[model samples]
Target chain A: MNAIDHPLVTAYLDAVARETAELPAERRAELLADLREHVEASDARDDDQVREVLTGLGEPRTVAASALSEETPAGHIHPAPVAPGRAKLTVILLGCSGPLLLASSVVGTIALIAGLALLWGAPRWETRHKVIGTATAVAVPVLVFVGALLGAASRIGPIELLLLLAFSLGVPAVGATVLLRAVRR
Target chain B: MNEAGGRVPSQLRKGLLEYCVLALLRDEPKYGVELVAELSAVSVMTTSQGTIYPLLSRLRREGLVDTELRDSPSGPPRRYYTLTAVGLASLTEFARAWPLFRDAVDHFLTDPQGDPA
Candidate 1:
C-alpha cells in the first residue's frame, strides 16, 4: 500500500509535516514525501520496525533543528572571504619575514614585527605552532647577532660571517615552512 | 550511543551527519528509508529517522543532491536521491580528511602525557 494504514505512523508524519511548516514549500513537501515513503516501505505488520523507524527519526523539532543549521557536506560552512584571505596573508608574511631579515634591519624589523602580529592574530594556526614560529623567528636572529658580535671581537674569518648568515636565515625559514604546513593541515 | 542521554553525540552528529548522507549516496541513489536505515545503523549518528529528511532537503538546496520521483514496486511513487557531482566531490574531500583528522585526535588522546605545548 502507498499510504501507511497504521494510525501511529500517520500521526507521526502529520506531526513532522506540521512542525516543519516553516521550511520552504518544496522542502516541506519533499520531507513529508520521504517520511511517508519510509513508513510505507517498512514491514508495517512488525511493530518493532515501526518503533525503531520512528525512534530513529526522532522528534520533529530536532529534525528541523539539524537542517536549519547551515552545515555543508564537507562538514563546515563556506568560510568567510576575509578569513581565508587573512590566513593566506599570515602565511605569506611568515614566509617572507626571514628573507627580509637579510636586508636592512629597519625593513627586516618591520616585516618581522608585522609577521609576528599577523601570525598571532590569525585564527587558522594553532596556538602551539604560532608560539613556536614566533619564538624561533625572534630568537634565531637575535642569537645569531650576539654570536656574530662575540666572534667579531675575537677577529674571526669570513666563513664565520657566512655561518652567522646561514643560522640566522635557516632557522626562521624552516620554522615558517613547518608552520605553513601545520596551519594548512 | 545516546544511551547515556548526553547531548554531545547529537551536537557532534550535527557536523558529521550530512557527510554520512553523501557517503551513503556515493555508492548509488537511495530512497529516504534506505538512507535513514543505513545512517541509523550507527546509533550515534541519529536518534530519529525524521531528522535525515531536513538534512536531505538542505543538501538539495545546496546543490549537492537532486531528487527524482520514481514508481516503487510496492507503493506510490518514491523520491530517490542522487548525488550531484558536487556531492561526490564533497564526499571525496571528506573521505580524504577524516582519516587524518581521526589520527590527529587519536594521537592527542593516546599521548596525553606528550609535550604540553
Candidate 2:
C-alpha cells in the first residue's frame, strides 16, 4: 500500500528508465534509486497525494532529458563516447573470436576472456559497448558448445549448422563493428 | 490527474542549479528527499525534483561533494551529502560572480532601448 507501489508511480519510473537507457549505468541507477527514495519519503497516503507527488516529479521523459543534457556540454547527447577507440586489441579479439572459438582451443578461451577484460576496462567504450562486446564474445562459445553437443547427438541438421556458422561469424562481426563505430564516434 | 501546468522548467536556471545545490549544502548536509523539498519550494527553480540527483551525482563524481550514511531519527539511514572543500571553493566563486552577472542581465532587461551607459 506504499505510495511508490502505486501503478502510476511505477509507470512514471518505468518511463524514466526507458528514456534514460543511454545513460551510464551507475548514473542511471542512482537517478532512479534517488527518485524511488523520494517517492517513498513523500508520505502520500492516498491516490490524490500520490498523483500530486508524481505531478511534481514532471514527465519522465523530461527528467531523462535533463539528466542526459547535464552530461553534455552543448546540450547535444551522443549515445557513445566522442573519443577514438583505443581498444583495438579488444576489438580484434572479439572480431576474430568466432573462428578461434569454433576449434574449441584453449587459446580461443584465453583470447575471449582477454577481449572481455579489455572491453570492460577500456574507458572510451561505454557500458553498452562493453555489454554488446561481452554478449557477442560469450555467445560464440555458447553457440558452438551447444552446436557441438547437438551435432554429437545428431539432433542438429546441416541447415542449422550452416546457420550457426553464419551467426557465429556474423554476430561477432556486427558486435565488433558496432563497438568500433561507437568509440570512433 | 497529471497536470501539464504543474511545473515550469526554468531553462535559464540550468547552469546555476548546481551552485544552488552547493549553497543548499553550505550549512549542513541533507538527505535526498530533504534536498528535493527545499529545491521545489522555489517556483522558478522547480522542475522534476528528481532531476537534482543527477546533478548531485555529477558533483560527487567531480570531487565537489561527498556523501555519508547517517542514521536518521526515523525510518532509515539517509545518505547525507556534504560539501567538500572544492565545492565550497566553487560556490564561493559563483557567489562572487553572480551579482555582476545579475547586474549585467538586469541592465539589459531594464534598458532594452540600445542604451550604452
TM-score of chain B, candidates 1 onward in order:
0.90, 0.86
lDDT (Cα, tens digit) per residue for candidate 1, span A24-104? 577667677777777777766666667776765677677665555533445665532225566666656666665576666
TM-score for chain A of every candidate model? Answer: 0.52, 0.50
**What ranges in model 1 sit over 4 Å off?**
A1-3, A46-52, A70-185, B115-117
- Candidate 2 lDDT over A23-110, as tens digits, reads 8888888889888878888889888999999888878987898888777758554445433434678888888888787766787888
Alpha-carbon TM-score of each model against the true structure: 0.56, 0.63
lDDT of 1 by residue, B1-117 (tens): 346237877677777889999988887899888888888787777777677877888788889999998888866788889999999999999999998888877878889778733
Identify the leading candidate in terms of TM-score: 2
Using lDDT as the measure, the top candidate is 2
Q: For candidate 2, what is the lDDT?
A: 0.81
Weakest 10 consecutive residues of candidate 1 chain B by summed lDDT: B1-10
Evaluated on CA atoms against the true complex, candidate 1 attains a DockQ of: 0.43
- Model 1: how far is A141 from its true place, Å? 72
> In model 1, what is the error at residue A88, expressed in angstroms?
46
